[model samples]
Target: MNNNTVDKSVLNTASVKPKVLLDDAPLSKFHIKIAGLTFGAHFTDGYILGIIGFALTILTPQMGLNALWTGLIGASALIGLFIGSLVLGWISDHIGRQKIFVFSFILITVASFLQFFADSAIELVLLRILLGIGLGGDYSVGHTMLAEIAPRKQRGVLLGSFSVIWTVGYVCANIIGIYFADSTNPDIWKWLLASSTIPAIIILLLRIGTPESPRWLESKGRIEEGQAIVSKHLGENIVLDRQEIASDAGFKLLFSRKYIKRTVFNCIFWVTLVIPYFAIYTFLPLILESFGMSSNHSTDFLLNIILLVGAFLGIYFTAKFSRRGFLIWSFVVLAAMLGMLALLPSTMTLLLVAVFGVFTLIMSAVSNLVGVFPAESFPTEIRSSGVGLATSVSRFGSAAGTFLLPLSIANLGIQSSMLILVAVLLVGLVVSVLWAPETKNLTLNRASKD
Candidate 1:
């Protein structure tokens, strides 16, 4: 008998008594709450990530920020996200999801309010890092919990909504920025940074009675407790899937031969998608101005509006296509759009803006896959671990990109910056063609293991 096991490997030999186990369970209000909670959490995340871009425009001048300070402020939250996801994400898998679920919002809410009082660039940087850490914990566990609770038939739709929900939050932040943007008000950036508190509090309250993932409990050999929660919330008809025994699912397993390929693939999948997205979006106002367009949040508003529309389109396409096919095709279109942006002079204002809008729409549509693949790729025991590591790695890469974009543009110009991002997209496209899995319709078990 092999002793290495993640959760309930004994279930591999046990028979399920119920006809409708978790995978086939009907969608219920409970599931809706799960989805809603995760969505709200992600929405706050997007707002935090997006609001910094707008706030920095004011903070730079008000605080007299140099390029170095500006990059640190821009990348601070991302670097914090990297740490939070790497550390707390692993802890959640070991300690249980519910604790981290409640604790994250507390951190976010507190950090957001603190932003209103940030007087120096360094103080604001520290506050942003704290905010990012809270979001990092949420990012690690929220999607994992959603995937585990959703019906397999609708899991794609539920988990897939993550990216779009995030985009909507980002759009909302941009809208708010446009509305409150006042060069005369040195205090405007403070309010913008503090606004994140609203969503955090709402999500925290909603999370109060949420149940832990039964599958996670079962994996940890707490079968009766797992059964009790499922039966209590989902009724006796719902049960957990049988898990195979005799495999260690420790974090180290992510680098083992069985998972290393997937670990690398998932990391690459996300890192490429977000690196350019964050870098460009974080400084979008400046980028627009560099293109001889309005930097006064008007053009940014239009781009964000397109992103909002693209988010709904993303929901439809995420549910409609194979994961592998959708990913590869999206990257191709993304690269083409960037190529157009790179070659056409920014002097072609309307044409350049139009191309960028098309790019934003396409990017939003396919970004949904990021939510689905990481959760669906790993088995129950290490699901959050895989997701966390992916989030951590991607945030690190994005932090680098966000920190460097200004420097790159200063040295190479905006067109050259777009071309470098184009190359990044091509690399993702190539990797997707080579290794992206077709897990669109598979059961969580099969998706994770086979």
Candidate 2:
């Protein structure tokens, strides 16, 4: 449509609040189906990005890559992610979620498979960028679809599961990387890079039955079609939480007075969280070795497992606490951890390990809300666009950080790098305190209005 997307979904949503079937619906197989589809997509996401750190270790010497080339190769996928999530997210909002949702993995699968033939550093970077484009698009559409359809009571856990599964996939990649570390074969990196295709294929196949979000359908004023899907899939008695009459909506609507604040607010939290995360994790083995904490990869392995466990814990906290409370406190705790790490002496290895573990744990927990917050922060017409905007902004920061991290280590030392991270987290903490809205227990329509 046009830029006139003045949502009426929230108008009558406050009335008959107790009788909304979707808000009260219990967990069912249909929900599991959708959840599984997202899980596979996220798992592939983790595998693709996570394996690169290790693969690059083997590829670096063989390919004769310098710091600049290494940084460009590493940051390329995230750069592609910045472009893909921004453009495709708006497209999904206008047309539909499932088409992009299913098609994304196809790009991921093909690009991943093509990595084996890459000869030059630039060629490999191009392949990774292609994979990231698919990944970024899926990030916007996959989370949006799940958020819209999840039961209100279990929304936090269902949506937050994205973080948990992602960590699991990342951990699995680490395990495989560790196994491959023992091989003397020079070309092992190609196998590791190309291996993501298997999981990507599986995810693509399982996504065959995913239905489009009924909220998206009805939000576009396709009420009968939306209702038909609801009855055929969910129970006939399950009424949607919001009844939307389609209004004009465009990319410009996201920057309108009503939503520009939410857009900026979500982007701040997302960017600060992901910059440190992807930058640090993508080069985790190298960074840990520099700190003299993991001469044997033991420390790196420990942190990945802990990150996954912490992600699971985060899902609980998302359900257990207020959204605003969780967001503000998580930043507080994270900033402290990183700040302490910056100040602490490197000689204290055990203490460093403990502090690092705590940092990983707390960061993983808070990261869950990244998926939950954006989807809850905008109306259906602009929800994916809003989420994409945040994703694109965050990925830009992540790309820059990932690209610069090794350079920083070379010039500034690990201690100074940690301090810079402390600064970033502090920014997130301040922004969150000033702007984080309480969306807990509110319906999507109501939450977006906040």
Candidate 3:
């Protein structure tokens, strides 16, 4: 043996030095797999929320609940969701991502199971409120964790994939509801609601293998641990120190007039995208019925078709195009679809339904992208907070839309209300073109870099 052997022996002196296992590596196929699983877990609540909106329209009438009561009951989950999102996001900033991630899933899983036993409208509302709390946490924390851990180059595509998961959840719920609705058994809706929890359980199980986000770890001053994580996933040795981490000055820096303008702009831009999305998408079944379509299984089947096609294909487009370009097209396409519905005769309703399927696909994809923009805009320390606040505020528009849409249906009719909704989309398209930053090349770290 030579001097080289001695050097190797010195490097392997594990008895004296604790081994630092590398954790953060370059974007790997392995990392993407984990991110995808995380996305699935995050998506369970959104799917359940959307499906319940449609289900309530059918179930409320069946259960002898008034329409306003039905809408109020529908709004209750969102009320819980709004509060939970704000509270959990603030908590996520202080504690860590893992605990909240695990806890939210547990809450959602329990809430879902209870839906099977609900006997009255009041019980259903209470259960949904609990479910909303879980969803509230999931939306903020899930995206934050994924954004912190995902590689910079693929962040847009990966974040966009989270949107895909929500649509996937929606499609799954619709399929289950449509299939079981024809049965003489009244418990089929319960089965549909309960089945969603299975995916949440699967997500919680897979999360066991995930490492804490390196950026989040590093933010807490766990330098050695953070570096090890970076090394493992990146396949490169990364050296980190106090200076290399975000400084106190950087914290103060984001609030300067320059960054403040962008922050407010992004917050508003994201809200615009979400307003029409939640306004129309969440109330899809109600809108469909207003169009004179049979609200029987046919409505659910059509919604499923739109969600499934939109989930996979919209993500594919977002991955292929710039974020701004994809959003512009999504709005324009959706506006045109709604415009056609406004102009078409009642006899062409079937054709309009087909076009509306396409519209749902476009809006679903567009909404997916909207969810990613806020997390991408802020720095690490405030990433989750900024995203959470913006998302929570957007829910106001959603909550407002829930109340407002029914009134619009009663007064404006479906055709006129859709034209108004399309006008909102047109405004979003213009705002996105003017304001939304192209985050295609920035990493979470780089974007947040002071």
Candidate 4:
């Protein structure tokens, strides 16, 4: 409870090997349950975020939104996500992951329901910001919880499945968006936004009795409680091996010499990945139109299906290869695809579509890796904070890209914009080669210590 008491446990932990009892524990029903709950949260996040793409299409004409207003409406949630992840992520470290985890879904549900009543653009943007905050909090907390609980051998696959399940949510939203694209009703966007509440409610219900992270408990010197939770999930046969207990260095520690490299890696890689990713996917309808494809809901729906397939491939390969290897190759491939899109003649419809599909596939794979790395890179004491900062920073990039992309396309044209994204991916590829630490098969404790 106090610093003095926590210090005593720190000393005690130093002499022991600190074996995380659940590190190699067999997959159990509890793991599956928790995975389902966390995955549900991700699914909700995807739907909430993805639905905005179509909603904006409908809202723009109805509201007579100019380019600036359109950009602001699009970027509002991402800005909220930036703030939420930065603030709540740090808060979760002190308060506890479960409380933040549960409350976020509640917040999301409330926000989603409120969206149905929004009549003005400002009101809708405000509601979206609130929703984004909840989503940001869930992103950091859910991934950290999953990383802390999963077995090392399967950690990459399990965490990476967040992207796959998120794609399911995205595809579902696209399906619904396509269905409603032709609706003449002014309130159809409201219905689309409000529908996010369904999964959020399910996640809120499922997370009712979820356990706290044992690593977090041990870090706080609540060893007995931590052990009890571990035993409850991993079985009583497991033993706690004491390892060096890093001090509960607060957020300041993220910038300390020991962690600065990891922090930089997380920020740079994540920002680069999300900037083009959010810009491209969030405005896929527009991008398709630029490519001379019919900018119909059907075309957008087909592209998302390709994205889903790519996400599934990402999940499978995340388990099969080294994190560093997969990410390096993925970035290289993504950069190449972007370059091709920039250079190839737009009149080559079949070739352009084929290239774009492969681009979505590889980009989704790398995006899954982006989600996994930040959670794996930090100690339990700062895991949520580290992930939060990375996520927040990435959201900023996404916001900037999403906001300015229309302007960029207007000024620079589609080919030139694609070239710029190609440059961004090349930077990411270099970072992956120079800085990506090998994280596959490492326990949370072991990975953090690296």
Worst 10 residues of 4 by lDDT: 237-246
Q: Which lDDT tens digits does candidate 3 get at residues 1-450?
A: 675555756666744533322222356775676677667865685668666764664576579887677776667677667766777876777677778877887888888889889888888878877887777787778888887766566667778777777777766666665655566666666776677778877877877756666777787777777777666665444433232454443324445654664466555666666666766766766666666655666677667677767767766776788876887777788788888877787677779778877877777777667556777887776666666666676666566667677778788888878788777778777777776777665555545432
What overall lDDT, based on C-alpha atoms, would model 1 receive against the true structure?
0.85
Q: Write down the TM-score of every candidate.
A: 0.93, 0.93, 0.84, 0.93
Q: Candidate 4: which pairs clash?
A: 16-242, 17-241, 17-242, 17-243, 18-241, 18-242, 18-243, 19-241
lDDT of 4 by residue, 266-320 (tens): 9888999989998998888788889887776666767777888889889888888
The regions of model 1 sitting more than 4 angstroms off are 1-18, 245-248, 296-298, 446-450
Which 10-residue window in model 3 sums to the lowest lDDT?
17-26
Model 1 lDDT tens row, 1-450: 566754575575364455578888889888898899999998999999888877888878878888989999999999989988888888888888888888889999999999999899889889889888888888889988988878888999998888888998998888887777765787989989999999999999989878888888887878788788878777777887776631446688888888887888899989999998888888887677777777655667678778888878888888887888889999999999889988887679989888888998998888888898898888777888889999999999999999999999999998889899999999999888888877776776434553
| Model 2: lDDT to the true structure | 0.85
Better of 1 and 3 by TM-score: 1
Whose lDDT is higher: candidate 2's or candidate 3's?
2
- What residue runs in model 2 are displaced by over 4 Å at the alpha carbon? 1-20
